[model samples]
Target: MGIIRTTVITGLLGTSSAAAYLAARNPVISPLAANDPIWASKVFKKHNPSRNPVTQDVCIKRIPFSKIRPELLQNDGPLALEFCRGVWSGWGFAVQRRYLDFKWRGPETSQHLWTNEQLADSTYEKGTAITDHFEVVDKTPSAITVRCGDSPRNQALRPSDGLFEISATIDRQREEVELRLKSCLFSSQGKMDGVKGPMPSWMEELHQWYARIWAETGSWRLLK
Candidate 1:
């Protein structure tokens, strides 16, 4: 029998439709700094190894109608709001892939929560579930926080068992919304890795893509 290859198209995490006002801005594509040799080496290995290169597409957009802080929503157009969502989603996806093996829970149509069974199925060779629980720790009109286990991907990676803490914060302001994400992992092999960074490279590229879309369509005006 021939091998069946499947392609998973993990679409952008936020915003669906394009806006109608801000359409003239130029796309941004600045190269990452070369001074960080370690990061550069890892990125190069991940993207251009001798054999297979794992590629994933990223899209960013705003979550329309989200209850953003009134002050922030007052002046920014749809483009800005959607851009925030895209950034959040893009960063969130990177965090998930790095720290957890996530599966959908809470209704097929819902985007929140993953089922325990799904989590169980994603155990590492050492017999550990990727995530324990995802909780909404706090919320305000302008900001929210989501807390997960230290090594949320597998049960083997629990804070009580010397894991780290992971959380994400979304802060909305008059002109923009910032997504601050953090993850700490205490590996079973006695390794400690922590990340407090922006979204991945591909995600940044997607933001540029969204900017282009807004520019081309001239659709950044707020909807009534």
Candidate 2:
């Protein structure tokens, strides 16, 4: 029993010392570590590609102009200038128009809300324009909803026929912003041929835009 115990203790110490030596030699093991079975497994797990790469349609909407506070709109020129500045500074894009038209009260006394920023014309000019319109869908003192689209743009560029929508809502109560994007890709030339996938890159870009907008407006905390 004494000899067996001595052997076990020696074995454990040997294993511990070997492990420490190995760890010291390779202090950091990246995901691509060639000798690491765990790293190899992780890399292999991410190698997923499909012949039928899913595509999504494009769309965008905004909150209504009417629901925005009058104070927010009190100085249209300065407000627009500020918003435009934010848009350009945040996204590195320029716009031709400062404000979007909003029809209310039988369209006679309608109002206009400035866009946070417009996409650079060069970005969409080459594509077939699908739809480009803005409308006020809702109004309230605390909140507003507006919807806009570039279906014409999509229609021109889409390889096949499909529907895409992108809309955003500003929550005055929570001071939060949410964007909803839906895309449907279809083979315009064929039947029963389509796929759907999330637009992670686009979503990431939108988030950056939001952050830039907040920074430009000096309202970073307003959307908390």
How would you encode candidate 1's per-residue C-alpha lDDT over 7-102 as one tens digit per residue? Answer: 111222223342222122332323323352322333233222331212112122232345344433553333243332332233323344333334
Each candidate's lDDT (Cα)? Answer: 0.29, 0.29
Those runs of model 2 whose alpha carbons end farther than 4 Å from true positions after fitting are 1-158, 161-164, 194-224
TM-score for each predicted model, relative to the true structure:
0.25, 0.25
lDDT of 2 at 32: 22
Question: With candidate 2 superimposed using the best TM-score fit, by how many Å does residue 160's alpha carbon deviate from the native?
Answer: 3.6
